[model samples]
Target: MNNPNQFIPTPYTNSVDSGNFTWSAPSNIALVKYWGKREPQIPANPSISFTLNKCKTITTLSFERKRHGGFSFDLLFEGQPKESFKPKILKFFERIESYLPFLTDFHFTIDTRNTFPHSSGIASSASGMAALSMTLMSVERLLNPEMTDDFFYQKASFLARLGSGSACRSIKGNLVVWGEHEDIPQSSDLFGVEFPFEAHEVFQNYRDTILIVEEGQKSVSSTVGHDLMNGNPFSEARFAQARTNLTRLKQILIDGDLKSFVALVESEALSLHAVMLTSNPYYILMKPNTLAIIEKIRKFRSDTNVPICFTLDAGANVHVLYPDEYKGVIKTFIDGVLSLFCEGGKYIEDKIGNGSELLTVNS
Candidate 1:
C-alpha cells in the first residue's frame, strides 16, 4: 500500500455506463501541525490530528458515459455553478487521471457543499477534497467490484493527498497520522493511517469549539506560507521540533495527561505561527481578535483551573479544545467571553468524530 504504483487500477472487470455517488467527509484539526511540505503534497514533518464532527463537506458526483475525450467535468457549489473552482478540480483530475483511467471515459458533474465557510481557515479544502476523493473511489469500485475495503480507503486517501496534503487525514476518523514517523507504526507519507494505539478514554470524546475571530479570506494562502519555508532560517530546527513534539504527544495521549496535552498542543500551534513569523518573506495570519481570544483562553484556564486550550489553523480563527466532561463550563465561557471577539459572534461547536461516510451509490 505504500507504493504509489499499487493504487493504479487494472483494466475494468465491469463496465459502468452511468452512475452516481455521494460522500461526506469531515474536517480535521492537527494536534501536531503540518505547516510545511515537499513536492507532490508530501509533508516536511509528521503530524497527527483529531477528526472533527460538525464541520464537513458533502459531495455528489454523477457521471455519464462519453466518447473518449480529455477530462470533462462540471462543478457546482451549493447547487450553484462555480467557475472559479474548476481549475483546482481540473488540476486534481490531471494529477489522478493515471490512477483512475475511467475518469476521461465519463463526463462528470460534481456537486458539493460545505457545512463550514470556505477558505475561512477551517480546512475546507481538506474536507471538500476528501469527500470528492471518496465519491470518485465509489466509481472505481463499481468498475472493479472485487476491491477490498482496505484498498478502497487507502487509494481514496492517496488521491485526496494529491488534491491537498491535509485532505488525506480527513479520510479517517478519531486519530490519523500522516508522514513517516518512527514512533508511529504503519505511518506513511503517501497517505494518512489510523493511529494504531488505543488512546485513553479521556480523549475519546474531546470537544473542539471553533471561535471564528475573522471569517474573511486570509491575506496569504497556505500554499504561499508553505513556500516561504524554503528560505526560513529555522526550517530545519522547526521540523526537528515537530518530530520531537509528536513523540511526546503520543505518550501523553496514552496517559491522558491533560496538563501535558495542553502544553504540547498550544506550543505546537504557536510554533507553527512562529515559523511563519520568522520566515524570509514573513507574514502574520493571526488577527487582533485572534490574539485577544488566546489571551482570554489562557486567563480563563488559569482562573477556573479548567483543562481548556486553544489551537489555530493557518488563519485567524481559534479552535477551543477541551475534554467533553468540561463542555458545560466551557460553553458558558465561550458564550459570555470568547464570542465577543468573534466577528458577528460566529463560532462552531464540534467534537472528535469517526471519519468519512459513503452516503449513497447508484448505478
Candidate 2:
C-alpha cells in the first residue's frame, strides 16, 4: 500500500473499524453579505451571518488505522456515497494534516446529511463543511484530548474553508463574522460568539418562506459569483450597497427591531442577485416561481402590514424570513401560496440552527 505519513498519489480506504463522530452545523444566511472573497480559498472579503434554527447538516468522521499503510476516506451524502462530490475534501484533509501531521496516515470515512433539502439553495455547503469541521475536531479529541477550543477552531475553521467559503460560519454559533479588514475590530476568525444580543430575544418575531422552483443551476458557483462580481462594472456598486446594508442591519440587530431587520435582509438579497444580473454573459438564478414568490411577498407584506422578507443565495431557492411568532401564520401563508401556484411554489421551510458537534464516535 501507499505510505500515508508521506505523500501518496491515490487515496485509500481505512481497514480498521473507525470510530464514529457526529455534529450538527447550521445553515447561515449572510446578513452583512459577502459578495466577494478576498482569498477565495479562505475568502478575502469579510462577512456576517445568522445561524438558522431549522436548517442544519450533520456529519460524522470515523477513522480506521493501519499498522503499516496509508488510509482513505469515503463520503456519504444523506446515506448515499459521495463519489467525486468535491475535490475540496482532499484539500480539507491536507489543510488539517498541516497542523496535526501525525494524522496524515490514518484512513477516514465521512458521512454527511442535511436536515434541509440539498441543492435547494439553502446554504447546504456552509452547514455541510461546518459539520465536517466539528466532526474532525471530535476525532482529533479522541486521538488527542489535549487540544484547546482556540486551537481546534483556528485549525478546523481554516480546514472547513477549504471545503466551502461559507462553511467557516457554520462552525460558529448564533451569529458570526468572517475575516474582515482592520479599522474595525469586528473581523477575525471568531466562532461560537453569541451576538451582542440574545438571538431569540431579538429575532423571536421573524419568519422566512422559501419557494423552491427549478430555475436550473447556474453555470457559476459562489466562487465564480465573487469572481464575476470583482470584475463587473457594478462591482463597486454592489460593494457600496452591501456596506450600507451591513451598517443598517447591524443597528437593527442591536436594536432588536424586527421590521428594520426584514427590510434590510430583503434588500441585501436583492442587491446580491442584481449583481449577478449584470454579469458578463448574464446569470440569473431564479425560476418563474421565484418572481411569483417576490410578488406574493410584496402582496402579503402589504396585506398583513407585517414585514416578511425574502432572500436567495447562489442557488435558485427563495428563503422567506419573518418573526418566530409568525411561523404558524407564515406556514399557512406558504401553503396557500404553494396551493395557488401548484407545483411551482415548492420549497422547504427552515429556521436558524446550531453549529457543528459529534453525536457518535464508534471505536
Candidate 3:
C-alpha cells in the first residue's frame, strides 16, 4: 500500500497567479494486455504496450483564481463546449483532488482534442487522462519549481492510473510496462515504467496502422468487462499466464526474436478477446470484418514472410504492427487488399512514437 511517489507539497508560488499548461499524450496498444483490475486501479495482470504516434490527445488547462474558495471548470472538446464529457472530467478531478489540493482555489478552463476519432476504437481514455494528468503536473511545477522532470512523469503516470488503468503507460514513450512483476525491475502497481531493457532496432521503428472495423461505441464498456472478472472462472489462470508472457516478451524484445515476438503478440491479442468471449454473460467485440482482417494478415504474413501481426484493444479495431523496412509493401497491401475491409476505407497510418510531448505557450 506504500506509494513511493506520493504527492504532498505546500504551495511554493502565489495562489493568485494564473497560467495555462498544454500537453499531448499518446494512446498505447498493449502488446501484453492488462484486462482486469484491483483497488486504486491496480492491474490484475502485467501489461506492456507500444506507444503510438498520430493518435493522441492534447489537453490545455488555463487556471485563474476563484472569487470564493471552491473548484470550477469548463470542459471543451476540440473547440466547443461538451456537456457529456464534463461529468467524467469532474469525476477525475475529484479522484485526484487529494494529490493536488490547490484545485479548490482556482477556476480552470480545459480544452482537449484528439487526433483520431473517439469512434476509432483507439484507447482515447488512456491518452486523454494522461494529457490531463501532465497538464495538472505542469501547473504543480509552476507552483513548486524544484520538481525534477523524472519525478514529474512518475507522478503524472501515477495520477493518470488513478483515472484509467491503461493510461499510466501513455505517460512514457516507446514500450512501457504497468503492474508489479518480479521479472521486471522497478515495476509497480501504482504506475507504469518505460520497459527497462534495450529494445532491438527492429522494434524501435515499428509501424502501427489501425484498421477501424466498427466506428462506434462498444456494446460493453471496459468498466463492466473488468467487473465481470471478479467472478471469472479463469481469472487466476489468466493472471498466471500473463506473468509468464511478460517474462518471455522481455527476453524476446531484447534478443530481437521476431518470430517469437509475432507469436506472443498475436496470442496475447486473441487471449484478451477470448477471456471476454468465455465470461459468464459472454460478449463478443469483434465484428465480421475483424475476423476477415486477421485472416488476411495471417495469409499475407505466410505468403510474403513479413513480420506483420495484429493486436486489438477492448473494441473491434485492429492494430497492424510491422517494421519500417516493410512500409512500402504494407501500404500496398493495405491499399489493394486491407483497405477494402476498412470502414469507409479509413485506417490511420501511425508508427511507434518517441512518447508524449508538452506544448507550452512560448513554444
Candidate 4:
C-alpha cells in the first residue's frame, strides 16, 4: 500500500491557482447490460462489468490557476482536435461543479490519448471518464484533502456519466456493478445469498474481445438510446431481463461454465438491442456486415466447437467472450474476420484491470 503518487502540498483555497495532474482509467465491457437510466447519472437497471485488461485513455490536465470562469476544455479525440465536443465538454465540467461544488471556475488544457482506436468500436468513454475521475481526484486532494471515498466514486461516476453511461462503472475496480440500477442495489441483496453476484472469483477470468463491425460512430447516442428504449413497448420487459440476466449470469460465473456464460451474454446483448428495434421507428445498431461477422463466428464455433460467442452494445461492434485458455482459437477466428473488414480490423488483448494509480505525483 505504498503511496507512490501521494502528495503533501500545502492546501490552497483558491480555485484560480493553476496546476496539472496526469492519470489513466481502463475501459470496461458490460456483462449484464444496462440500457436505460433513471438519472442519466445513474443506471435504471443494474449492470455488472469487467474493467478491461486492454483499452484505456490517459489525460494530462493543466488548469489555468488564476482565471475564474466556467470550465473550459481542450478535447483531443483520437489525437485530433474535435471542437464539436466543446459544448458537451463545458456542460460536463458545469455538471461536476453543480454536484461537487468544489470544482467550479477553472480553465483547463486537457490532453487525452486513447490506447485503442476510438472509431474502431472500442469503448473510449469508460477509460476516458476513468482518467478524468482519477485526475480530478488527484487535483481535489491537492486542493482539498478532506474528501471522502464514498463521495469520490459516486461523484466520479456521476460526472463521467454526463459524458457517457458506461463511464459510471469505471470508478471502481475490476468487477463493478452500479448498485443504483435495480430496486435492489448491487451492493448486496443478491436473492439473500451470502455473497452478492458480483463478488465471485470466477468472474475474474471473464474477458472480452471488441470486434469493430462498423468503424463509424453510433447514430444513436446512449442518452438517445435510453429515450428510444423508454418508447419501446418492450422496455419494461427488457429491464426485467437485465436484472434477471445479472442474477443468472452471476451464478454461471461462479460455476465457471464457459458455455452457459457465453449463451447468456450473447442473448442479453441481443435482447437489449432488440428492444431498440422494437421501438416505433425500429432502428438497428447492426451494420450490414455486422451479421456477417456474427454468422462467421457462429460457423467457426460450429466447425471448431470453440467456446466463444459475441455480444454487442448499442453500437455495431461486438464483444467476444472466451476463457483464457482458448485465446488462440478465438484470436485466430478474429484474424480471419478482420481480414474481411475495412482498413481497421486489428484487435487488442485485454483482461480485467485495476483502476487508476498515480504514475507520478510531483512534489
Report the poorest 10 consecutive residues by lDDT, candidate 3. Answer: 1-10
Indicate the residue-level lDDT of 151 in model 1.
88
Better of 1 and 4 by TM-score: 1
What does candidate 4's lDDT look like per residue over 1-363, in tens digits? 112112222345634366778777777788778776655355667787777765878888776553464455677665688787677667666655644444555566677888887787677767787677777766776566566765455555555665676776776667676643343343521101112444446456756777666776788777777777667778888878888887787667667777787788889878877888888777788876677777887888889888788878778877777767777777777787644653365556677776655565542
lDDT of model 4 at position 348 = 61
Best by TM-score: 1
lDDT score of residue 70 within candidate 1:
94
> What TM-score against the true fold does each predicted structure earn?
0.98, 0.84, 0.97, 0.84
Overall local distance difference test of candidate 4 = 0.67
Clashing pairs in 4: 16-65, 17-65, 18-65, 53-351, 179-186
Runs in model 4 lying further than 4 Å from the true structure: 1-16, 76-81, 148-151, 181-202, 341-344
Per-residue accuracy of model 1 over 1-363 as CA lDDT, tens digit each: 367898887788998799899999999999999988888888999999999998999999999999888999999999999999999999999999999999999999999999888745688999999999999999999999999999899999999999999999999999999999999998999999998899999999999999888877888888999888889999999999999999999999999999999999999999999999998788998889999999999999999999999998898899999999999999999999999999899889999999999888888
Query: Which residue runs of candidate 3 sit more than 4 Å off their true CA positions?
Result: 1-5, 10-16
Q: lDDT for each of the candidates?
A: 0.93, 0.66, 0.89, 0.67
- Name model 2 segments beyond 4 Å from true: 1-18, 40-44, 67-71, 181-186, 189-194, 197-200, 215-217, 342-345
lDDT of 1 at 271: 97
RMSD (Cα, Å) for all candidates, in order, is: 0.9, 5.8, 1.5, 5.6
